[model samples]
Target: MNKSELISVCISDNRVCPMPPQWVKFEELLSEMGNGKPPQSLILGYWFDTSDEEKRKCVQQQIDWAYERGLLDFAIEYLTQLKPNQWHTGYRK
Candidate 1:
C-alpha cells in the first residue's frame, strides 16, 4: 500500500488512535518518508511514547499492519533503536 492509503487506514482505524487528528501530521510525515527511507528519530520518539497498554496494543496493530505491507523492518529498526521511557497518556511518570 502507498503512504496515503496507509495514513487513511491508520486514521480511520480506532485501534490506531482514538483522536485521529492528533496523529494526522505525524502520519503525514511518516508517509512522506516513503517506503525506502529509514524511519526518523521523531517517529521513534513518538512510538516510544506509547506507554499505556491500549496505546501499545494499537501500536502493535500498526506494526502488524505495516508488516503486512512490507514496512515492518523499518518500523522495527526505528523502535529498537529508541530508549524506553514512561510516557503513558499525558503523564511522563
Candidate 2:
C-alpha cells in the first residue's frame, strides 16, 4: 500500500487507549496529530517500535468502532482469519 494512503503514525504516542474513560485521551492524541475530524477512509497505521500488546489494542479499538456502527460483518471475516502477529504490521508476512 502507498505510504501516503496510510494514516501517519506517531511512535511517541503509540499506545492505543481503550474505550470508555480513555477514549477521550485517544481523541486528544488524534486531535494533536491533526486528525480531529473523522477520516474519509479507514484510518490505519502501524509501527515496529510499539509493543505487541499495543498493536492488539489498536486493532481491538477498530473492531469496537466498527461493531458500534453495526458494521462488524465488514471486518470480522478478514480479521478473524489472521494470526495474532499478522495484525501487528501494515504489510503481509
Best candidate according to TM-score: 1
Best by lDDT: 1
Question: Estimated TM-score per prediction?
Answer: 0.40, 0.39
Candidate 2 lowest-lDDT run of ten? 2-11
Across 7-77, the per-residue lDDT of candidate 2 in tens digits comes to 22311133232322233334343434432432222123334355545554554555455445544554444
Candidate 2 error regions (>4 Å): 1-46, 83-93
lDDT of 1 at 35: 47
Task: Give candidate 1's error at residue 12 in angstroms.
Answer: 28
Residues 1-93 of candidate 1 have per-residue lDDT tens digits of 544444344333223332333334334534555443322222345656644455545555555555665765565454333333312233333
